[model samples]
Target: MKTDSTDDPRTDVQTASDPCQTNRDHVEYVGMHVDDRPVVLNLTEHERLAPDRSLDLIRQSRPGFEWGDTGSGSAQLACGLLLDYTDDEAVASQHYIQFRDDVVSQLECSGPANCWHLTGDDIEAALASVTGHEALTPDGGTPTPSLPVNWSAVNRSERTVFQRRDIDHYVVLGEGTEEWLLLLCAQGDRAYPAPLDIRTVPIEEDPAPAVRELVAESNDLVEPEENA
Candidate 1:
C-alpha cells in the first residue's frame, strides 16, 4: 500500500487486492471507538490497510497546496496531527464536508493521517456526530488542534491501511460551534521531536485526559522550523 504525503482531495473505487467489494467492515474496520457526545468520531479500521509510503509521495490538492516555505518537516509532517475543532456555531454543514475533501484528505500529515480511511461515508459519519450538539464559540474557523497524539499507534502487521496509503493527510472531522476532533487508526515523519505514543480513539470517543493533555501540550507540538 503506497501512501502519498501531500494531503489533499483524493477518492477512488475499490482496489484489486480488496477481498470484499461490498464493504470493509470485516477487514477494513478492525476496531471501533464509540461515544454519546455531541461531536463524536467513532473511528475504526482494518489493521492491515495502513499504507506504506512516505511523505514526498503526497500530491497537493491544488497548485499552492503542495509546497511549504516553512513546511512541517518530513519529521513534523510525519509527527502527530493537531486535533483542532471548529468554532463556528453557525457554520454550514458544507464546510465540514469540504474539510474532509480538502485538508484532512489533502494537506499531508504523517501520524494521524496515516491510519485513517477518509471515504465519503467517514465524512458523513463525522458530520452527523456533531452539528447542533454543543454550544458554538465563534473562534473564527477551525479551532487550533492542540493534541499531538502519536500518528503511529497500531500493530504494524505488514498490512496497509484500507484506503490507498499513498494519500498523506488523515481524517479530521469538525462540527458547528466548532465541536470537532481528529481520529486515530494507526499511522508519521522525523525533524520535530517524536510525540509520546498515547493511544486513544478519535476525539469522538471523548477521552477527557487525552484531549486535555493534547490541549495542554498543544503549544509544544511541531511546526515548520523557523529560519533565521
Candidate 2:
C-alpha cells in the first residue's frame, strides 16, 4: 500500500523553493539592539528599514527608536514598526502612539544578543486590541476637548524670575499664599507670538526645596542681563 503525499507531515512545511510560497506577502520582522543602536530587518525582503524613514512620516519626538519603556524613543519605534509592517501612512499615523504605549513599551530584551520578532498577524492582533476610545484621528487629534485653564484666577507673587540675556525667554517661579507655580514664557516680539508654559505644585509644609529644584531644572534660564 502506498501513502498519499497529502497525508505526509513533511509536505506541510513551506520552503523557499516552493512556488506557492514565493508570492506570498512578507510578514516577518526581526529587531535587535546592537552597540547601543536599534536595527530592524524585513526578513522576506532581505532588507533593513531605516529609522529615519519612519521619522520622516511622523514628527520626531525623540532622536531615535527604542523599546522597553514608555518614552519618546519607544514611541518612535512603535510608529516605525507600524509604518513598515502595514505600509499604510494613515493606519500608522492613527494607531502608532497607542500601539507604542500598549505593546512596544512592554518588549524587553534581557541580554545584548537577544532579538525580538513580530509577524503581520501579531501586528493585526495588537491593532485589534486597541479600544475604540483610544483611537486617534489621522491628524492625531483626540476626540475629547481639553479644559481651559484661567491663569488670571491664581493669586501668585513672583518669587524669582530668570531672563535670558540674548532673548526674551523667561522662567518665573511664583508662590501663592497657598500654592506654588512655575511659568516658562517666551515673550513675543515682531517676529512671533508669545507662548506660555506653566507648571504648578501644591504648597507643602516647606516650599524652599521645591523652589530650588524647579530653578535647578529650568535649563532655558540663563544669566540675567548685566545691571538691567
lDDT of 1 by residue, 145-214 (tens): 3322222122223321111122222222232232334332223554333334334343212333444444
Off by over 4 Å in 2: 1-26, 110-113, 134-228
Point out the worst 10-residue segment of candidate 1 by lDDT. 31-40
Against the hidden true structure, what lDDT does model 1 obtain? Answer: 0.27
- Residue-wise C-alpha lDDT for candidate 2, range 1-228, written one tens digit per residue: 453666422232234543222233647766665555776666667677677878888754546777887766777788888988888888787777678878888876532235565667778889887645332111121122111110111222434554433446544667675566766667756365244566676432223344334333433244433442
Error of 1 at 126 (Å): 0.5
Instruction: Give TM per candidate.
Output: 0.20, 0.48
- Give the Cα-based TM-score of candidate 1 against the true structure: 0.20
Clashing pairs in 2: none
Kindly report which residue stretches of model 1 are placed more than 4 angstroms away from their true locations once superposed: 1-14, 19-116, 133-228
Which candidate comes out best when scored by lDDT? 2
